[model samples]
Target: MPKRVDHEDRRRQIAAAVRRIAADRGLEGVSLNEVAAEAGISKGFVQHYFASRDDMLRFAATTLRGGIEERIATPLRVRDLLVALLPLDDAGRDDALVANAFLVRALKDPEIAGHFRTGHGLLRDAVAALIAAAQADGDLAQSVDPAAEAGLLLALVAGLGDAVLLGYQTGDEAIALIDLHLSRIAA
Candidate 1:
């Protein structure tokens, strides 16, 4: 009997392969051949989920952005915001690597770039909203400029992600650094 296929599961598996490929190889080198080999699936099977290399990349980008957005929206106390943004372990590092890969790919592809920009804007907006809410509740400092501070928070998150991904810092160190950064924030 043929092996049963779970279409969504297989699709997610393929997307995971896409992230690994881009993480290991530059995005320009990503192809069905390489992805199939990396994923340990047939080349034709890779095509089953994606029509072309671009489709695969786009799907991967969408998936990564969706995940980050979901995490950002998680109902956490204001104090946990920075902690949620910081990658503090193997799982977090892998997720950051995947996120960085998508952002890097966006640098060269217009379609990917648009998605990246939109995602970035959404994150910044969320940060602003959170900060503003905290300040209104008298939980944040009145002196902080929500918009400017939100941008800074986003930059710090990106820097922390890069440091963790590049081995410049361990996950624990990253989390500690983020805590220090958070101490300076209004809320």
Candidate 2:
């Protein structure tokens, strides 16, 4: 009998290797051999899943977006979702590193930039919906624009994540700042 290959699992393994490389070295001059070594697989194996470096990166970006969407899909409160975006743990830090690395590349690559724009837009829309719900429930002020508030919240969280990554502010301090902002917006 032939061995059954889990294609999705193999793809995710390759993406994880890419994330590790991006986090460690900023994704510049990364080769198939390097990725294969990091993934503990052969270069041919990586090629079997991805025909080119750009394809691999696209897969990694999609995987990253999927992760964020999954977290958002969970039945968590608005505060919990905001907290989850912070680099409060090793996994979050790794994610932040990979995301920042890709962000630079996205500025130059239109395809990559599209992926990021779509992901960010979806996340922002979801947050806006949540804010609208809060306003309906009288938790947030009626005068606040849900779309505008969601955009500011997302930008603030992104800035806070960068601060945490740069060691300028601790994760707890960022979270406290977020809570302070939320309190000011409460109805």
**Candidate 2: which pairs clash?**
none
What's model 2's TM-score? 0.92
Candidate 2 lDDT score relative to the true structure: 0.87
Please report, in order, the local distance difference test score of every candidate based on alpha carbons: 0.76, 0.87
For model 2, residues 1-187, the per-residue Cα lDDT tens digits are 9999999999999998999898788888467989999999999999999999989987888777755565567744567788888888887888888889999989988988998998889888888888888888889889889899989999999999999999999989999999999998999
Worst 10 residues of 2 by lDDT: 67-76
RMSD of each: 3.1, 1.6
State the lDDT of candidate 1 residue by residue for 12-95, as single tens digits. Answer: 788888877665665765889988988899999999888998898887776776555556677444546666776665556666
**Candidate maximizing lDDT:** 2
TM values, all candidates: 0.79, 0.92
